[model samples]
Target: TQASYETTSVYGHGHPLYYNNVINCLRGEAEPETDGREGLKSLELLIAMYLSARDGRRVSLPLEY
Candidate 1:
């Protein structure tokens, strides 16, 4: 379900074709996109899954139940 960014040149700051930014633009949010933050969240989920498997324990969210 990912949007395509292949047409945007690097000098374009990789804008326009990027999915989140487009959605935000349509919504008039005008805030920055979630490019790096999305990757960070994916990494966090991977780490959580790894820790759960290694420790043989259920890994729950630390802040919220």
Candidate 2:
């Protein structure tokens, strides 16, 4: 997406921190930031955003999927 960002920020829009966390978790250096349920919530919200944009309507939270 290449949004405006600051390289010094630990939490950038490109999600370097997220990938780092995943790698660290895989190497047993850190715990997973979120479990499946939390991940599901985020996925649902992202899908809802796309649906709302595509259909030109508001999408509700906690999608059925």
- Scored against the true structure, residue 52 in model 2 reaches a CA lDDT of 99
Residue 31 of model 2, lDDT score: 100
TM-scores of the models, in the order given:
0.40, 0.69
Least lDDT summed over 10 consecutive residues: which range in candidate 2? Answer: 5-14
TM-score of 1: 0.40
Judging by lDDT against the true structure, name the best candidate.
2
Cα error, candidate 1, residue 53 (Å): 0.5
Candidate 1 lDDT over 1-65, as tens digits, reads: 99765654664654454666768777998665656777677667878898889999987754132
For candidate 2, write residues 1-65 as lDDT tens digits. Answer: 77765666775555887898999999999999888899888889889999999999999887765
Q: Report per-prediction Cα RMSD to one decimal.
A: 8.7, 5.7
Off by over 4 Å in 1: 1-34, 62-65
Deviation in angstroms for 25 in model 2? 0.9
